[model samples]
Target: MKKFLQKYSEFMRGRYGVDDLFYFLMISTLILGLFPNFLLKNGLGLIRWLLFGFGIFRYLSKNFTARSKENAWFMKVFRPVKKEIKFLYTRIRNIKTYRYRRCPKCHQQLRLPVRKGKHTVVCPSCRHEFEVNIRF
Candidate 1:
Protein backbone atom coordinates (compact mmCIF):
# COMPACT_ATOMS: atom_id res chain seq x y z
CA MET A 1 0.00 0.00 0.00
CA LYS A 2 2.77 2.44 0.96
CA LYS A 3 4.78 1.63 -2.15
CA PHE A 4 1.76 2.18 -4.43
CA LEU A 5 0.95 5.45 -2.70
CA GLN A 6 4.53 6.62 -3.10
CA LYS A 7 4.51 5.64 -6.74
CA TYR A 8 1.27 7.55 -7.30
CA SER A 9 2.61 10.69 -5.65
CA GLU A 10 5.81 10.48 -7.67
CA PHE A 11 3.78 10.15 -10.89
CA MET A 12 1.73 13.20 -9.99
CA ARG A 13 4.71 15.48 -9.38
CA GLY A 14 4.96 18.54 -11.68
CA ARG A 15 1.39 17.85 -12.95
CA TYR A 16 -1.34 20.44 -13.37
CA GLY A 17 -3.53 18.69 -10.79
CA VAL A 18 -7.22 19.57 -10.14
CA ASP A 19 -8.96 22.93 -10.23
CA ASP A 20 -12.48 24.49 -10.11
CA LEU A 21 -13.25 23.92 -13.81
CA PHE A 22 -12.52 20.29 -13.29
CA TYR A 23 -15.04 20.01 -10.44
CA PHE A 24 -17.67 21.89 -12.44
CA LEU A 25 -17.26 19.58 -15.42
CA MET A 26 -17.39 16.53 -13.16
CA ILE A 27 -20.56 17.67 -11.38
CA SER A 28 -22.22 18.65 -14.63
CA THR A 29 -21.35 15.25 -16.06
CA LEU A 30 -22.84 13.53 -12.99
CA ILE A 31 -26.10 15.48 -13.17
CA LEU A 32 -26.45 14.98 -16.91
CA GLY A 33 -25.72 11.31 -16.56
CA LEU A 34 -28.93 10.85 -14.53
CA PHE A 35 -31.23 12.10 -17.31
CA PRO A 36 -34.28 9.93 -18.10
CA ASN A 37 -33.80 9.88 -21.89
CA PHE A 38 -31.67 7.03 -23.15
CA LEU A 39 -29.93 9.23 -25.71
CA LEU A 40 -29.17 11.90 -23.14
CA LYS A 41 -27.83 9.31 -20.73
CA ASN A 42 -25.57 7.86 -23.39
CA GLY A 43 -24.36 11.29 -24.44
CA LEU A 44 -23.64 12.30 -20.87
CA GLY A 45 -21.86 8.99 -20.31
CA LEU A 46 -19.59 9.74 -23.26
CA ILE A 47 -19.09 13.27 -21.99
CA ARG A 48 -18.25 11.96 -18.53
CA TRP A 49 -15.59 9.69 -19.97
CA LEU A 50 -14.18 12.54 -22.03
CA LEU A 51 -14.12 14.93 -19.08
CA PHE A 52 -12.36 12.33 -16.93
CA GLY A 53 -9.84 11.64 -19.64
CA PHE A 54 -9.23 15.35 -20.08
CA GLY A 55 -8.71 15.71 -16.34
CA ILE A 56 -6.16 12.89 -16.34
CA PHE A 57 -4.44 14.37 -19.37
CA ARG A 58 -4.19 17.70 -17.61
CA TYR A 59 -2.88 16.00 -14.49
CA LEU A 60 -0.11 14.22 -16.37
CA SER A 61 0.70 17.11 -18.73
CA LYS A 62 4.27 18.47 -18.60
CA ASN A 63 3.58 21.81 -20.30
CA PHE A 64 3.17 23.84 -17.13
CA THR A 65 2.97 27.23 -18.85
CA ALA A 66 0.16 26.20 -21.22
CA ARG A 67 -1.80 24.47 -18.48
CA SER A 68 -1.49 27.46 -16.17
CA LYS A 69 -2.52 29.83 -18.93
CA GLU A 70 -5.58 27.72 -19.73
CA ASN A 71 -6.60 27.65 -16.08
CA ALA A 72 -6.08 31.42 -15.84
CA TRP A 73 -8.25 32.02 -18.88
CA PHE A 74 -10.99 29.81 -17.51
CA MET A 75 -10.88 31.71 -14.20
CA LYS A 76 -10.96 35.08 -15.96
CA VAL A 77 -14.21 34.02 -17.60
CA PHE A 78 -15.70 32.28 -14.56
CA ARG A 79 -14.92 34.69 -11.69
CA PRO A 80 -17.52 37.38 -12.36
CA VAL A 81 -20.27 34.79 -12.81
CA LYS A 82 -19.21 33.07 -9.60
CA LYS A 83 -19.22 36.42 -7.77
CA GLU A 84 -22.73 37.26 -9.00
CA ILE A 85 -24.05 33.91 -7.90
CA LYS A 86 -22.51 34.37 -4.46
CA PHE A 87 -23.89 37.91 -4.20
CA LEU A 88 -27.35 36.66 -5.12
CA TYR A 89 -27.15 33.88 -2.59
CA THR A 90 -26.23 36.31 0.18
CA ARG A 91 -28.85 38.82 -0.94
CA ILE A 92 -31.56 36.19 -0.90
CA ARG A 93 -30.37 34.94 2.45
CA ASN A 94 -30.63 38.45 3.90
CA ILE A 95 -33.70 39.51 1.96
CA LYS A 96 -35.39 41.01 4.99
CA THR A 97 -32.48 43.15 6.15
CA TYR A 98 -31.21 44.61 2.89
CA ARG A 99 -32.17 45.62 -0.61
CA TYR A 100 -30.24 44.88 -3.79
CA ARG A 101 -30.07 47.13 -6.82
CA ARG A 102 -28.02 47.48 -9.97
CA CYS A 103 -26.17 50.51 -11.18
CA PRO A 104 -27.82 51.84 -14.30
CA LYS A 105 -24.60 52.83 -16.00
CA CYS A 106 -22.32 49.91 -15.23
CA HIS A 107 -24.78 47.36 -13.84
CA GLN A 108 -22.81 46.80 -10.67
CA GLN A 109 -24.73 45.44 -7.71
CA LEU A 110 -25.60 47.95 -4.96
CA ARG A 111 -26.74 46.96 -1.51
CA LEU A 112 -28.73 49.15 0.80
CA PRO A 113 -30.56 48.84 4.06
CA VAL A 114 -34.31 48.32 4.11
CA ARG A 115 -35.98 51.72 4.27
CA LYS A 116 -39.35 53.21 3.54
CA GLY A 117 -38.41 56.03 1.22
CA LYS A 118 -36.78 56.93 -2.04
CA HIS A 119 -33.05 57.67 -2.00
CA THR A 120 -30.21 58.38 -4.37
CA VAL A 121 -27.78 55.50 -4.49
CA VAL A 122 -24.22 55.94 -5.65
CA CYS A 123 -22.31 53.05 -7.07
CA PRO A 124 -18.87 52.77 -5.48
CA SER A 125 -17.40 51.09 -8.49
CA CYS A 126 -18.32 53.53 -11.26
CA ARG A 127 -19.55 56.50 -9.20
CA HIS A 128 -22.90 56.39 -10.96
CA GLU A 129 -25.91 57.79 -9.15
CA PHE A 130 -29.48 56.52 -9.37
CA GLU A 131 -32.73 56.91 -7.47
CA VAL A 132 -34.09 53.85 -5.76
CA ASN A 133 -37.47 53.46 -4.11
CA ILE A 134 -37.20 51.06 -1.23
CA ARG A 135 -40.48 49.48 -0.21
CA PHE A 136 -41.52 46.10 1.01
Candidate 2:
Protein backbone atom coordinates (compact mmCIF):
# COMPACT_ATOMS: atom_id res chain seq x y z
CA MET A 1 0.00 0.00 0.00
CA LYS A 2 2.76 2.42 0.98
CA LYS A 3 4.77 1.41 -2.12
CA PHE A 4 1.75 2.07 -4.38
CA LEU A 5 1.09 5.43 -2.70
CA GLN A 6 4.77 6.43 -3.16
CA LYS A 7 4.71 5.40 -6.81
CA TYR A 8 1.52 7.44 -7.44
CA SER A 9 3.04 10.47 -5.75
CA GLU A 10 6.21 10.10 -7.86
CA PHE A 11 4.14 9.81 -11.02
CA MET A 12 2.09 12.93 -10.19
CA ARG A 13 5.28 14.85 -9.39
CA GLY A 14 6.81 13.76 -12.70
CA ARG A 15 3.70 14.62 -14.68
CA TYR A 16 2.50 17.95 -13.19
CA GLY A 17 4.21 18.58 -9.81
CA VAL A 18 2.57 19.34 -6.45
CA ASP A 19 1.47 22.94 -7.05
CA ASP A 20 -0.09 22.45 -10.49
CA LEU A 21 -1.99 19.32 -9.47
CA PHE A 22 -3.15 21.05 -6.29
CA TYR A 23 -4.50 24.02 -8.22
CA PHE A 24 -6.13 21.78 -10.83
CA LEU A 25 -7.76 19.67 -8.15
CA MET A 26 -9.00 22.69 -6.26
CA ILE A 27 -10.53 24.23 -9.42
CA SER A 28 -11.99 20.89 -10.52
CA THR A 29 -13.61 20.35 -7.14
CA LEU A 30 -15.10 23.82 -7.17
CA ILE A 31 -16.47 23.37 -10.71
CA LEU A 32 -17.85 19.90 -10.06
CA GLY A 33 -19.38 20.96 -6.76
CA LEU A 34 -21.27 23.89 -8.31
CA PHE A 35 -21.94 22.91 -11.93
CA PRO A 36 -24.85 20.49 -11.94
CA ASN A 37 -27.19 22.03 -9.39
CA PHE A 38 -26.18 25.64 -8.82
CA LEU A 39 -25.18 26.50 -12.39
CA LEU A 40 -28.60 25.70 -13.85
CA LYS A 41 -30.41 27.55 -11.08
CA ASN A 42 -28.20 30.68 -10.96
CA GLY A 43 -26.71 30.67 -14.46
CA LEU A 44 -23.33 32.07 -15.61
CA GLY A 45 -23.57 35.34 -13.67
CA LEU A 46 -23.19 33.59 -10.31
CA ILE A 47 -20.67 31.08 -11.74
CA ARG A 48 -18.57 34.02 -12.95
CA TRP A 49 -18.05 35.11 -9.34
CA LEU A 50 -16.74 31.65 -8.49
CA LEU A 51 -14.50 31.80 -11.53
CA PHE A 52 -13.20 35.20 -10.40
CA GLY A 53 -12.39 33.80 -6.99
CA PHE A 54 -10.56 30.91 -8.64
CA GLY A 55 -8.63 33.41 -10.78
CA ILE A 56 -7.62 35.42 -7.70
CA PHE A 57 -6.48 32.26 -5.88
CA ARG A 58 -4.57 31.10 -8.97
CA TYR A 59 -2.88 34.50 -9.36
CA LEU A 60 -1.84 34.55 -5.71
CA SER A 61 -0.61 30.95 -5.83
CA LYS A 62 1.51 31.69 -8.90
CA ASN A 63 2.96 34.96 -7.55
CA PHE A 64 3.43 34.61 -3.80
CA THR A 65 6.05 31.83 -3.48
CA ALA A 66 9.55 30.85 -4.71
CA ARG A 67 8.37 27.99 -6.98
CA SER A 68 5.60 30.23 -8.29
CA LYS A 69 8.20 32.94 -8.98
CA GLU A 70 10.02 30.53 -11.30
CA ASN A 71 6.73 29.69 -13.07
CA ALA A 72 5.90 33.40 -13.40
CA TRP A 73 9.34 34.09 -14.87
CA PHE A 74 8.95 31.27 -17.39
CA MET A 75 5.47 32.53 -18.40
CA LYS A 76 6.72 36.13 -18.73
CA VAL A 77 9.66 35.17 -20.96
CA PHE A 78 7.64 32.68 -23.04
CA ARG A 79 4.68 35.01 -23.79
CA PRO A 80 6.81 37.94 -25.04
CA VAL A 81 8.98 35.68 -27.22
CA LYS A 82 5.92 34.08 -28.73
CA LYS A 83 4.29 37.47 -29.31
CA GLU A 84 7.45 38.93 -30.91
CA ILE A 85 7.80 35.97 -33.23
CA LYS A 86 4.14 36.34 -34.28
CA PHE A 87 4.65 40.08 -34.84
CA LEU A 88 7.76 39.46 -36.95
CA TYR A 89 5.92 36.89 -39.07
CA THR A 90 3.01 39.29 -39.65
CA ARG A 91 5.36 42.18 -40.52
CA ILE A 92 7.45 40.13 -42.97
CA ARG A 93 4.47 38.85 -44.92
CA ASN A 94 1.76 40.96 -46.59
CA ILE A 95 -1.71 40.14 -45.16
CA LYS A 96 -3.23 42.78 -47.50
CA THR A 97 -3.06 40.12 -50.21
CA TYR A 98 -6.31 38.71 -48.73
CA ARG A 99 -8.14 42.02 -49.01
CA TYR A 100 -11.75 41.74 -50.22
CA ARG A 101 -14.13 43.85 -52.31
CA ARG A 102 -17.72 44.46 -51.30
CA CYS A 103 -20.33 43.09 -53.67
CA PRO A 104 -22.59 45.65 -55.41
CA LYS A 105 -25.70 43.48 -55.20
CA CYS A 106 -25.71 42.25 -51.57
CA HIS A 107 -22.76 44.31 -50.27
CA GLN A 108 -21.09 41.15 -48.96
CA GLN A 109 -17.28 41.12 -48.80
CA LEU A 110 -15.68 39.18 -51.68
CA ARG A 111 -12.07 38.01 -51.91
CA LEU A 112 -10.49 39.36 -55.10
CA PRO A 113 -7.03 39.67 -56.64
CA VAL A 114 -5.18 42.89 -55.68
CA ARG A 115 -4.71 44.50 -59.08
CA LYS A 116 -5.56 47.82 -60.72
CA GLY A 117 -8.53 48.50 -63.12
CA LYS A 118 -12.03 47.02 -63.30
CA HIS A 119 -12.57 43.27 -62.90
CA THR A 120 -15.55 40.89 -62.85
CA VAL A 121 -15.96 39.86 -59.17
CA VAL A 122 -18.34 37.19 -57.88
CA CYS A 123 -19.89 37.18 -54.42
CA PRO A 124 -20.20 33.64 -53.01
CA SER A 125 -22.59 34.73 -50.27
CA CYS A 126 -25.29 36.22 -52.54
CA ARG A 127 -24.27 34.55 -55.83
CA HIS A 128 -24.10 38.01 -57.38
CA GLU A 129 -21.77 38.91 -60.25
CA PHE A 130 -20.62 42.50 -60.67
CA GLU A 131 -17.76 44.61 -62.03
CA VAL A 132 -15.53 46.07 -59.29
CA ASN A 133 -13.78 49.45 -59.70
CA ILE A 134 -10.36 48.44 -58.41
CA ARG A 135 -7.61 51.08 -58.08
CA PHE A 136 -5.17 48.63 -56.52
Clashes of each: 0, 0
What tens digits encode model 2's per-residue C-alpha lDDT throughout 80-129?
77687886675446445644567778877566656778877768888887
In the range 20-62, model 1's lDDT, one tens digit per residue, is: 7667666766776666386464554566678767767776788
Best by TM-score: 1
**Which ranges of candidate 2 are over 4 A from the true structure?**
1-58, 61-98, 104-107
Model 1 residue 119 distance off true place after TM-score fit, in angstroms: 5.9
Model 1 is weakest, by summed lDDT over 10 consecutive residues, at 36-45
Give the Cα-based TM-score of candidate 1 against the true structure: 0.71
Note each model's CA RMSD in angstroms.
Answer: 3.4, 15.1
